[model samples]
Target: MPPAANRPRAVAIELNAVLVALIGDEPQVLTLENGALLPSGPFEGDHPTLQTGLRAWVERQTHHPLGYVEQLYTFADRSRAAATLGRRIVSISYLGLTRERAAAGEHEPGWQSWYRYFPWEDWRGGTPAVLSRQLLPRLRRWIDAAANAMTKRERRQRVEVNFADATWNEDLVLQRYELLYEAGLVPEAAARRPIADPLPGAPMHYDHRRILATGIARLRAKIKYRPVVFELMPPDFTLGQLQLAVEALAGRPLHKQNFRRLIDQQGLVEETGAVSAETGGRPARLYRFRREIVIERAVAGSKLPLSRSS
Candidate 1:
């Protein structure tokens, strides 16, 4: 065995929160350091469970209480800097759903629209202009500049599937971000090569942006099969509000009729015997999510894909 000094040091654990909320027709993520980092802190022993440690960290860092929290993937390999410093950092991330409120922290924390960090991922109208005007052309150069024909073919295949002109799968948010990272098309990967024109989006500190992408991909996928989206909604909301929230997360303009039909068929929500004039010019019916339905089992997917007309 190696001497004590030569042995590997204890791993340092970090807890991070990808707190999500809907604001002004967009899905927003709670961030710190002027929207450049997710709320995170060291996992201290004052907490009993891993989750307790995470909650304390988030509340302390962002001053936002977590609701409907779930464990996100651990990023143990995020230790490039730490490794150089003779330490290992294993980040245990969590996804927390909460309503937006005024942030209270010394860290200049605020809720940033998820799309601002991933402009190409939004397809509410159609394919983002950055995809064609900026990303694909830049990616083409990266492909052509590859060392050999084999690498070029592989790059072409990934770009076609992820940023395709045909149909786009919204759940590929993390995959797309990772592809951009690999192609050095993202600011985070600028160290790999001098990105002439960095892809349109705000870059987060360290690997926090990648962690955010993972959290978003999970939420986007979870909402499709479950009522997880309701966690981010108010107790009473109009069907229109619900649909808008879903679109904001899915990043696609869902067919309204189809979305409402699926929600009804799945028995996900019901009338609260109240109407909201929140939508201008007309009163819309207010509905609350069927809380008990979650206990019984969420029956159907929200049927998120946009049809041709949408």
Candidate 2:
């Protein structure tokens, strides 16, 4: 350990949350200042643990209780002001799942679709137009700008695997964002010059967008094996509604027959015997997530298993 005078300066723990809710057909995150910042506050001594602190802040600010909350990542923000003040600021981030409350309009400023900040990740309809017409062309330029042949080869490989690969992996959210940030393609990057056009996505305050991506990536992966998707769903829903919720988070379309087949095989949902006609044409049967399945069975990714069958 260093001497008293040489010891590290003050450390302040900041709690940040990416409160997610499925709004309409999109996965929206609660934000402040008209959708510019994630909900965050200083960690107080009253809280016992990090997660407890995060839950408190989110619940107080949003006025909506968090259903499924998990720690995502801890980020260190070393701004000039903090350094000058002899302080180190660390943000402990969490991902909270909840349904959009009707009363959000009163307290929360905005609940914008997370895709607004990462448009390239969505492939539910098909490949996002921005990825083909914008991201790819710019990524090619960045690949070509590499200092050496070896570096160019490495960058090209990353692009191929993360972006241009024939099989698009929905969980590469953070990796995709980092590729753009490293190339100064995102506004959050501390580049010497401004990015022209900048890959066409909304930017957030500080490194909040990166934290949001971390949360999204975690969710996209978790829903594959865990029943966390139900946290974003209603008490009872149609097979179509459940599929839409999964697609909203995964950003990929799943085959109706194959997806429902997996749910049946996994015994994830039980029919509530109620039908909803909102789907149009036919009255769809509603099902509720079997809360007991969490302990009764170990779902091997079959609950949300997407074969993408034709």
Candidate 3:
């Protein structure tokens, strides 16, 4: 038998919350009172399954039932928290999708703009002015400070990929933040001193911002191959709302004519004979996602052509 000291110890189960809601044209995440993230509590030997536990946790806190739920990942990093003394606590993270309901006037889950946590991710107005104005210069200085040739090359590669002259790759959003963390460039890594004046985006209590980046990256990639974009849409929507959802995920505007053409060609949606007056012109027709395609293809996805201007 293996020595007792080498054997793995049983850890209490911990659940992490990743509550996302759409605001205007972007997602806002929920946070708690403590500096610690607003993740769910321990399984507490109460849950029969992870999903059941998640549903309960969300409803009890937000009073809004979750519409779509998916397990994100498990985290148990030693540096994550000072909990459990020296023991590493395993945290199961989940990506929960739901439309926000008005607060019942009681339980307060503070809503913060998701963009505040990820300023660089927004490009709906063409690369946030902040990136070109602030982040890039600091990043360049960090790049230039690399001591060796190989390190410099890696830094430049990160720069090129994260904030490249090439079209922004929506899928690499999380990877970009992680790369920054690893390079000791982000606020999370600069634990001891003030690195720069204000970071282009807001920082979270703990690793919540990083977790948000993970969700953004996952959704960006998922939308390309999984038809999950429908989760954020109304039961009926105008093509403009559809485009906005896609642009929100892609972080860039799509060509209007081409987007309509592609949606028509793919037959991913059907007109519902309903009209929305929200756009301030002739009422736009409403469309519903083709549920059949979602079931038949299961993982099928529609494409949104992205360019720098798109």
Specify the highest-TM-score model's number.
1
Q: Return the TM-score for candidate 2, rounded to 2 decimals.
A: 0.92
Tens-place lDDT digits, model 2, residues 251-282: 88788888888888888899998899899879
| Each prediction's TM-score versus the true structure | 0.94, 0.92, 0.88
True-vs-predicted CA distance for residue 7, candidate 3, Å: 9.7
lDDT of 3 by residue, 174-230 (tens): 887887676565778767455656565666665777777877777777777777778
Where is the poorest 10-residue window by lDDT in model 2?
301-310
Answer with 2 or 3, whichever has the higher lDDT: 2
lDDT of each residue in 1-310, candidate 1, tens digit only:
9997799877889888899999887899988878988988888878899999988888776667788899989998844456557678898899999875654655547889999999988888877899889888988998899999999899898888888868678888899999989988888887666877788899998789999999999998898778888988999999999988988898888888888888888888999999998799689999998889678676565657565346
Query: Candidate 3: lDDT over CA atoms?
Result: 0.74
Model 1: how far residue 58 lies from native, Å: 0.8
Best of the candidates, lDDT:
1
- Which portions of model 2 miss their true places by more than 4 Å? 1-7, 77-85, 102-107, 190-192, 303-310
All candidates in order of lDDT, best leading: 1, 2, 3
